[model samples]
Target chain A: MTSWIAGVDVGGGGIRVQVRTDDVGLKARDRGPVPRIAGAIDTSRLCGRIGELINSVVESGARPAFERIAVGLTGMPGLVRPAELADQLRLHVKTSSVVVASDSVTTHLGALGGEAGCVVSAGTGAIALGTDHRSTWNRADGWGYLLGDEGGGGWIGTQGIRAALRFHDRRDGGSEALLRKVEHQFGGVSAALAAIYNSPSPIHSAATLAPLVADAAHEDDPVARAIWVEAGRLLAESAFAAARGLPQTYSWGGRLFDAGELLLGPFRDEVLKRSPDAEIRPPQGQAADGALLLAARGIPAGAIAEPYVHEFA
Target chain B: MTSWIAGVDVGGGGIRVQVRTDDVGLKARDRGPVPRIAGAIDTSRLCGRIGELINSVVESGARPAFERIAVGLTGMPGLVRPAELADQLRLHVKTSSVVVASDSVTTHLGALGGEAGCVVSAGTGAIALGTDHRSTWNRADGWGYLLGDEGGGGWIGTQGIRAALRFHDRRDGGSEALLRKVEHQFGGVSAALAAIYNSPSPIHSAATLAPLVADAAHEDDPVARAIWVEAGRLLAESAFAAARGLPQTYSWGGRLFDAGELLLGPFRDEVLKRSPDAEIRPPQGQAADGALLLAARGIPAGAIAEPYVHEFA
Candidate 1:
């Protein structure tokens, strides 16, 4: 009865936390933004803050003897060192054991409720992680914006801007209407150009256009529609690449995926076309819930995807 | 006797100056590197240096009342302002008919010998310009490295690095050979990643791989060969787009084109496939000679291409 377990999902928009024990099913809370992968956030400061937040959520002593704590954060080990994060977390959080990982790892666990499957997390960036029943896992894309990020918002937005520029240059004369949509999205073409050309962190700025692209697509702009179509194909391609000869329970998760059918319709079509056995179902819970399952020792050792796990203890 | 008509073709590698009159044409001088477009180059200082070099070649007193001077400088009006060059030139020489223009326009003038044709200036960058018999002009794809530069060295090298990284990820099952080539080129896989991901001016750094990619292509690496093939197709597409409805005198002129048949064979096939009438011909003269034509009023007004012209006087 004294055992306590918790999970943390740290993302760009904000951080979400969940705590649970066998007697108590689950308790959850939502907070403001966390340090992004590599942008303006400091990992040490953020980790210490996360430790404080965990205490608040559990409503326990200053140093709760938690049985286990699992954290899924963006920028783990890629843009930021995983060891730095683990060392900082150990300094701040008092727990018998604490572990951190990529948000995609906890995503698959929470979304599938521990049943083996694949998940395509499409947000500012996109990554796909899949594990077969045998517990072997593989991942595709999500190499950040520089390398890849195929179907993510940043990718889609960049593609849209490229199309709009081509239309301005009269490459695709049919893209004039899309150009107007883009001009309107950024106040004007000049402003958009300035933002795109002059910005330091162009990925974040480009992602600001995702909503405009979605609306234009819904409005039947051929260029915009083409953007979503290619996005669907690329995202699915990433998923198929990661599925690695296994049946996949595919769940598309991300803020942009919130476009629902506007985005998922094409994504689903593309995913099913390649993997006829893929189950294009909705996610059962958010990433935080998956973290909760990890905290409570719900995920089996064999089923734990090692490719994504930065830490096991 | 004091009148001199001269053209200057300023590019990344070096500067070429051609001095001539109706009775005599002096051979052009190839000097050291000039200011490159969009790199760490100071325009005013470079312009003064160009002026000094021009005077030396003409064998005339400083501030000689030259009949006409036309300059084709890289980055002018794109990375550097045309006024900056003109103003700086005025400091070193006295010429009422001095005109500063983009290297691309001067390239087309020089390569075609003032004929109506498309010139694909392929180097660290790529730009295509075309003029019809009616004097109407069109340009395609020279938006620098960020937005475009599809067939340029930067594009080819970037694509190669991407392929190499994919091989590093073990994504391309058949890319082992290409990976070794990339490792050898960049001193190792780790250095390659650091150069690609950490360099401030990654375009220039990535372009350094162009030669390595060319060698790998010749060695029969499928991935490397694919890079060249795609480069050829994209460069040709840019030419075709610029040619518009007119019959184009297509000339591919740049340092990377120095790969001779290794680069041009595939490019020729692609260009000829789309443009059967495209006369695959070598440049009649170098860019400095083309600028000399501009200075001497050799370019006919009827077939003049002004889209790339930075100055008219």
Candidate 2:
């Protein structure tokens, strides 16, 4: 029987799991986000959640034990104890070999398929990583919503909402269409303001408005279109910054890119503006796939170091 | 015996009370911010805190009763119940006449002395109010930190911190001096990020760093100076927007203006850019002084309406 391998993606939105053998692969998702306690990853609950997702996807009669497992998560850098996560995953998934790393690393691997290039991921937040899975690892952005994440969904949505508020206040740079959309979406500007400021996860709440911006942009709203254009340029800057020493090949992943040409057209223009020789390609897969590949093949020699990626056997 | 009148400024930083009766004005202050519960003013606690401050300043043997009392408070618009606050305060300070109004209204009164001009108040947040204290009341900004409050202390501080983070990440728009100052101020970048993000009042925590940006600007850091320049411009824009239908006379209040020429230089330029005939002047006093003036004279005829200002006797 082919050895089974599992990969987990723990992100701001939720948890997703994939269990695969050479012959078949199964996927499952849970809406619960990776638990955070006092600004750090809740490793125990995260491992348990990953195990449950993986086990549910595998055959009921078959042993839930996996030969290898890899987990990629948000808020992992400097805050997560990867070894502890690996240890806990071993207890939960019955895997002898495991790898735990930041989602940025996995995103890079999945986008470039372990090649030495750059990948920018823009979901609720944005981050770029350039690595050969070895000694050359460069990162840009991902400083959280308050400090960075310039071109992410949170950034785009915030601009949209601010424009709406400007319209409500009769200030310059107001967007009437965006104002109507926001008022319709959140009942009223005051209610929207109250809800977002009082929200437990305000960044995510702001990010939920990204689509509203995109919709307005598609309708030819100048202010909304300008927001996306700027977002695309900023995201491109992030990708290029990470790709500094690496080959100029770049790819991207994340739901924010689902805005399609509205984001990509400007993103491509900015990338080409930076390097005429740059190669831009669609992502090969996603973070979970990268985790699965790492579990199956193990981290390449010198791909990463401690405090970034941890391994257990 | 002369009757006493009191003015209270309830702000994000704390509370201050000034009691006067023509001959003497005794001032008392409390570091406790106006209590907020569920995003609305905690009127009962606010009145009690004001009472405690007012009573502490009056002679123990003398009656604390005032002929009139006026309170200018943050978060008062659409949230505070003037009648309820009046009832509560009567039990505490024995006030017969009370006027409750939004801090924006009082800031304008304090800056322009109730003239028909615009006043921009820029502390942790920023707001512009243009009113004749009769029929026309024009407001701009003050949408809070997330959606608006542009050119405010929070905005300037956030830009300063963002520039520092960019330097840390070796990204474009980085400010080396600001980065050094921030790390020095907060022990390290990581600690600062954690503290600011996890703070109960993130906006105020961010605004606390505004002085650091000002310091860097004084040291001739281009990025820091640009931040101040932009802040000044945005503030002027708010003032102009509010002054649309009123006289082109403008003044400003709040601690943010303490940045001196670093802020005022550009602020004046922008105001003149909009109207070459504009008048810019120094504020006469603080918010508490405005409250005192209002208490002595009462809100002017057609100056304001319900939801903006409430009067009880």
What lDDT does model 2 reach? 0.87
lDDT of 1 at A128: 84
Writing each residue's lDDT as its tens digit, candidate 1 over B1-313 gives 5577778788877777777766777655555767545543566667777777777766654445767778887664446666666677777766766667678778877788777778888887887877642466777767666556778998888777767656655443235666788788678876776667677666777787889888888888888888888788778877877887666569867788887787787888878987787787788877787788888773355555343454434
Q: Model 2 compared with the native: what TM-score?
A: 0.96
What are the chain A TM-scores for all the models, listed individually? 0.89, 0.95
List the candidate 2 regions with Cα displacement exceeding 4 Å: none
Model 1 chain A — which ten-residue stretch has the worst lDDT?
A: A298-307
DockQ list for all candidates: 0.28, 0.68
Evaluate residue B132 in candidate 2 and report its C-alpha lDDT on the 0 to 100 scale. Answer: 82
Write model 2 residue lDDT over A226-261, tens digit each, in one string.
999999999998888888888899999888999999
- Report, to 2 decimal places, the DockQ of model 1: 0.28
Q: What DockQ class does candidate 1 belong to?
A: acceptable
Query: Compared to the true structure, candidate 1 yields what TM-score?
Result: 0.82
**What is the TM-score of each candidate's chain B when compared with the real chain B?**
0.88, 0.95
